[model samples]
Target: MTAAAPRPLPEWTASAVSPLDAKLGLELLEVSPERAVGRAPVAGNTQPFGLWHGGASCVLAESLGSLAAHAHALTLDLVAVGVDLNATHHRSAREGWVTGTATALRLGRTLASYEVVLTGDDGQRLCTARLTCSLVPPRR
Candidate 1:
C-alpha cells in the first residue's frame, strides 16, 4: 500500500498569531521546533528616546521562542504557554529592521526553552533574551 500523506503544518495567519505581533509590525521569516526567526521595524517600535524599545525586544523574543515551543508541543498533542521571559539590552537601534533569531535550548516533555538574539540590520546585537514555556494538554 502507498504511504499515508504527511500531516500539514500549522498555518500562521494574522488572526492565528498574537494581535500585538501585528501592532508591532513583526513578521515571521522562519519557523520550526528548533529555531524561529522574525523581524520588526524599528520606526514604530521605538521608545520615547527614539531608541528601540527594550519591551519590544522582549516581545519579539518571547514570541519566537513560544512559537518554537508550540511547534514542539503540537507533536506531543499538547499546547505551550510561556512561563518566563528574560531579556538584556546590549545596544540600541534607531533605524532599519530588528531581526530576532531564536534557537532552542531545551525541548523536554514538560517544558521548552529558547534563547533569542535580536540584531540590527548591520548585524549588531541589540538584545539577548530567553524564554521558557510549559507544555500542557489542550483544553477540550
Candidate 2:
C-alpha cells in the first residue's frame, strides 16, 4: 500500500504566547505539524558581549520544536509535553534576526521529535537543536 500523505495542520491563530518568547521578541511566521517557523530579533536577545545569547537560540529552537510537536499530537487526540531539548551553537549572530525552523523527524502515537535549525539573515547556520516530546492524553 502507498504511504498516506500527511494530514494538514489545524487552523490556529498565531497568538500563542510565552513570556520568554515575548521577552526575546520572537515572532511566529508559521506553525504546523510538518514544520514550525519563527524569528527572534537580536537586539533584545543579545548577551553582554553583543552577540546573540546561546540560551536565546535554545529558547527559539525549543519554541518551534515544541509547537510543531504539539500540533502533531492534536491530530491524534493527545497533548504533547517537551521531555528533552538540546542545542549546539555553531556561530554567533551579532545583528539582525535569527530564523528558526523546526522540522519533524518522527511523529508517533506516544512520542515526537523535531530538529530545529537556527540561521542568521544571511542564511548561515547559527545553531542546531533537537527536541523530543511525549504525547499523552490530555489531563482532565
Worst 10 residues of 1 by lDDT: 6-15
RMSD of 2: 4.9
Across residues 13-106, which tens digit of lDDT does each residue of candidate 1 receive?
A: 3344688888888888777889888899999999999999999999899988998898889889999999999999999999999999999999
What is the per-residue lDDT of model 2 for residues 1-140, given as tens digits with 9 covering 90 to 100?
99776444345635565888889898887788889988989998888999999999999999889889888998999988999998999999889999999999999999999999999999999999999999999999
What TM-score does each of the candidates earn?
0.90, 0.89
Error of 1 at 105 (Å): 0.5
- Cα lDDT, all candidates: 0.89, 0.89
TM-score computed on alpha carbons, candidate 2: 0.89
